[model samples]
Target: MQYLESFYNYLQYERRNSSHTIVAYKNDLRQFCEFLEQENIELWVNVTSKVIRSWMVQLVNEGVSPRTVTRKISTLKVLFKFLMLEDVVDSNVAKHVITPKIPKKLPAFVKETEMDFLLDSIEFGQDFTGLRDKLIIEIFYHTGMRLSELVGLMDCQIDAGNDVFKIYGKRSKERIVPIIKELKVSLVRYLNERDKLFPEKRNPYLLITEKGLPVYHKLVYRVVNSYLGQVSTVVKKSPHVIRHTFATALLNRGADLNAIKELLGHSNLAATEIYTHNTFEKLNSIYKQAHPRAEKMEDYI
Candidate 1:
């Protein structure tokens, strides 16, 4: 527990990690420590491969997903390695712990036709809120930016002349994502209404509520869920699904994986590769439909 307190301080000051990431790390480490306590284990140096394996088995028996168990194992590995470097542990006991192989599940994405219908259902009336929501959906689908990145955007981040917006992504890394021409037009229309709503107050954020305050995650989720419900019957309708929709659309249209990686602000190629499954599914469907031999013909004899 003392080590955890030190590690948290290290994360906050030394590593400069984000609050969300630090909180996840804290939770992971806390759970591991709790497991150790439950097993009557003490002293970091006494941690062994056997103990870690037992903990993993216990997690599995408790109905935790393989992916989650793997992540927790990864967190322990990092902590043990850190302890080893600090001389608090004799060695990294977690080194020999094999992580569970989680099955890759591609995120569900909305089809292009469904996306079109969703956008069309926005009903671009004279109402400022409707126009604003439409622009919000368009920007999200077109850019594939994380919800935080969109909400944290400032007026200075937009390059109106070039039609590109700079976003600070995970780890405070900045990337420029281009706005499509149509999205730009919609943004301009929304801004016009926005000015009418808050003519006296000037805020840098692109999207705001009727109260002229910055939009929050819940508001964004509601906006996305409401529109997606009208267009698709998918059970989960959130901003993340819109992000999946954007990634799949790009992959289906033959966009480069590396390009998408940069656009989506993925630090690793593996994170971006999930969209390939969607692409493969599309190709497989086409192959089955168009190829004469894809479906075996009954024996002529």
Candidate 2:
């Protein structure tokens, strides 16, 4: 436990990991520590690669997601590395284990035509929940914020007058996302609706439930899914899909890669480059249709 606490402080103070990542690391380590106790392994240094393999097997047998299992394995690897650095472990056995393969799937995004129809054609009611749901979708599409960052948003973080809001991304890295005029109007309306619902009550979170509690993950997912299900055929209709739509739209419109990266609060350009695939696909389609020699390329080849 002392070692675990030390590792946690290292992550917090030294590594400056976000609260979300810290929680995930703690949860994964807790499960591994429980397994250690069951196996009667007293010290992390005494744990072997064989025991780690056995745990991975158990996780697979219990039907844990391959992605999730891979993440847990990574957590163990990091922990063992930290232990070795602290001189508590002579060797890092977890590094010997291989990670599971994850499928390569492009991020799903709503088409521009589909979003245009959804926003312009659909008439969200003029009331509280209606305005809230509409604003939820609008914020996601407009700002490209992750679900957690948006959920954790506060009224003070929004600066409608300046047309920008402060976003706290992964690792709690702060960025300012400039909002458009339409979104600014939607936000003002949503706030008025919220105040009407909870006139005497006070909540710090910008978005809230009908009962005035801060909106959570499941509710946000349901809101995005239900709306997207009506308007889009994309298999993924979560807030992330909306985020992808925002990024892809920017890329397709000739937004600079670095600017998009900054706006999305990505830690690196690599993460932002995924959106380029969609733009490349669009260019390919255009070239096939309009390029004079595109259709007859095989003749010269």
Candidate 3:
């Protein structure tokens, strides 16, 4: 328990991990501790690779998905690595365990024409909620910001003069994203409406409900889903789909991968590389349609 407390503090204060991450780590360690107790293992040093393997097998036998078990195994590795560093354990037993491989999944995004229809053709309402919802969709589609970043965004973060807005991304890393010039119209309108509604009391957040309260996560999701459903038939009609649309759009338009990475506040290029598949797909489509020799083999054969 003392070690777990130390690990939690290390993740919170020293590492500055997000709330969701800290909770997941705690749950993983707690589950592992329960397994230890069941096996009559009282000391940290007494746990072995075989014991951990048995636990993994038990979890798999209980019908847990391999991906989930892999996540639990990752949690164990991190915990044991910390314990070894603290001199609480002699060896990191989790290092010997193999993680299950997961199938690669492509990021889901809305088509360019579909997004244009939603933004240009659709007429959102004129009231506070209407203007706010439109701005929400524009920000996600144009900026590629995560849901949490959008939720935590404040009024001061926007730079109307330069067309750039600031985002505090995963792990609180800050990056500047530029909004399209046309989006400024919606931006100005939303701000004007926000100010009009809350004349005496000011909320620090840029996007708020009619009651002047900061927008929460679920409300943002609801707003996105409601509007996206009108124009997009993509299986995923959430804020993340808008993010993927932003990235894929940039890639299709010849934007540099690293620049997109920086704009999206991704920590590494590998994270941004996923959008290349969408780009390649678009290119292959054009090649088959335009090239003279491309489909000649089909006719000749």
Candidate 4:
């Protein structure tokens, strides 16, 4: 509680973390602080490794997922590290705490054929809303950008001459994502239609509502979910699904992991490596179908 505000300011201004991240950190710290209060602890220095582990055990007993528990532990590490830098604590108590191991869940992606059907067979109509919706979906799958990046995309950020998008990803990190010719064509058409539909609107964002205001997160989510549901039975049909589809599609086509990491604006290659699991599944399926000995071996097993 003492240096919490200072830590938040450090995350916001010094680390340049997104507001979403800041809020998550805040919530995690609040929950930890509440746990401390229950233990009758009043100061940062009073927190111990044992108490932190006990709080973690309580969270698990309360049915929190291991993945979420890991994130909360990460929040504690950052908090105590900040506390040490500010001389609030002599040593970091959370540094040695063992966190729950998260299960490796493969990222879900839309099948290439299903994506093809949605774009090629689906008739989104010629109205402003329909055009906007189609373009939104195209951008998501083409760019592999996160929802916030797409929502905050500015017209000036699109480099038509270079056939690339200047995307501001998590923590305001910038990356250039190149576009294919087909996507370039779709983008040009959408920009023209957007201008014609809202001629006088001065919004700088690339995507906007029929009311000429910048499009919000829910609007984008609905557009992706509605279209993806028709083609993909994937339980989660959000914008991030399309982002997954984009990454998997690239990996399937032999795109380099490092290249994909750059395009997706991931800070490290480990985040991009998850797509390889999906690619491996695809190859395994193809092997089962194409290799004569594969099916025979499977039957023997």
Candidate 5:
């Protein structure tokens, strides 16, 4: 547990990881610690391959997704590796523990036509809240910002003249995403309304509620969900889905994967590669439709 505390401190201060990522790692480690405690195991040296595998099986039995179990295994492996580096443990039992294979899932996205209708129908003049929500949706779709990065946005981070906004991503890393021309126009319109709502305050957030308070995560989620529900019948209509829509749309239009990775603030290409599957599906459909020999000849026979 003491080592966990140290790891938390390392993540917060030294690694400068985002609070969300730190929380996830902390939770994963906590679950592992609780499992060990229940079995009367203490100290990193007491961890064994069999105990690790059993914990994984228990998680699966409790209906945890294979992806989640894999992540937990990764968390433990990293923790023990750190301990081994510090000579806190005699061996890395977690090293020999294998992660369960997870099936690749396609990223969900709204159709471009549907997204256009949703954005166009938003009545920005209805109220300050309406204006704010409109801009929020536009930014999410245009910029592909993670929810945390979008919520963490400050007013000073935007360089409107350059059409770019700075974001603080995971690990407190900084990246600049360019604003599309349409988004810039929409943002300027929102700013006009925002100024009327908060005439005197100097808060740095671009989006705020009617009370001039910076937007919170749940509020953003609700706004995204409500608007997406109007345009989509899909069960999972959230901000991340909008972000996915943005990525897939770009990839479909021939944007470079590496460029998209940077824009989306992905730490690795693997994280960004999911969109390729969507692109591949699109290509396959086109091939089936346009290729003369693509159709089966058995129907004619």
Candidate 6:
């Protein structure tokens, strides 16, 4: 517990980790420390790979999912590496601990038709709340920004003259995402309504509540959920699914993978590569529909 605070400070001040990520890392490390306390281990220097394995085994036995266990292992690896760098430990004991293999699950996305219906068919009124709600959905589908980044959007971050959003992504890394003409028009309408209704500066956030306060995560989630529920039957109608929709749409239309990586503000191409699977599925469907030999393969045989 002594070095835990310092480790957290390093993650915050030095690593610039988001608060949500820091809290998750904190919880994971606290659980690991509790495991150590149960085993009568007191010092980080005294910990061993074998002990870490035992902890992992205990987690599996307790019915933790493989993906969750893998994340916990990652947390331990980071913590031990940090400890080694700070000279709190001689070497990284968690380095040799093998993580459980996690199954790759494809990200969920709304269909293009479903998105079309939601954006075009749904009648969001000309009122301020209606304009704000419509703009919220449009921003997610157009920008592919994370929920946190969208919620924390400031008024000045929208570079209208440049036709791009200055998005600050994970770890405070900034990336500029260009906006389409349609999205830009929607954004202009929303800002005008927002300013007209409020008429007083309460917060710098671009999106705000009906009360003119900055929008919170739950509010944004509800807005996306409500609008998406009208058109999409996907189990998750949250902002993230819309983000997936954005990336998948671009990929299906032959946009460069590297271009999508930049637009989504992903730190690595691997993160953006997942959407290719979705695109492949779409292509496979098209192939089946168009190919002459696809329907009756027995003829070829």
Q: Mind giving the per-residue lDDT tens digits that candidate 2 earns over 1-301?
A: 5589999999999999999999999999899888888898898778999999989988988989889999999999899899999999889899989867776568889999999888888888899998999999999999999999999999889886788999999999999999899998899899887887789758799999989999999999998999898989999889999999999999999999999999999989999999888899889999889999998995786
Which portions of model 5 miss their true places by more than 4 Å?
Answer: 1-101, 122-126, 297-301
Candidates' TM-scores?
Answer: 0.69, 0.67, 0.68, 0.69, 0.68, 0.68
Worst 10 residues of 6 by lDDT: 292-301
Cα deviation of 26, candidate 4, in Å = 20
Model 6 per-residue lDDT at 106: 97
Q: Give the TM-score of candidate 4.
A: 0.69
Q: Report the C-alpha displacement of residue 193, candidate 5, in angstroms.
A: 1.3
Clashes of each: 0, 0, 0, 0, 1, 0
lDDT of 4: 0.91
Candidate 3: C-alpha lDDT: 0.89
lDDT string, candidate 4, 1-301, tens digits: 6889999999999999999999999999999999999999999999999999999999999999999998999999999999999999999899999999888899988999999999999999787788889889998888898999999999999888888899998888889998888788778788888888788878788889888999999989988999998988999999999999999999999999999999999999999999999999989999999998998899788
Cα lDDT of model 1 by residue, 164-253, tens digit: 999999999999899888988888888888887788767778788899899999998888898888888878998888899999999999
Candidate 6 lDDT score relative to the true structure: 0.91
Q: What is the C-alpha lDDT of each candidate?
A: 0.86, 0.91, 0.89, 0.91, 0.88, 0.91
Lowest lDDT sum, 10 consecutive residues, model 1, at 292-301
Model 1 local distance difference test score: 0.86
Q: Where does the lowest 10-residue lDDT sum fall in candidate 5?
A: 121-130
The order of the candidates by lDDT, greatest first, is 4, 6, 2, 3, 5, 1
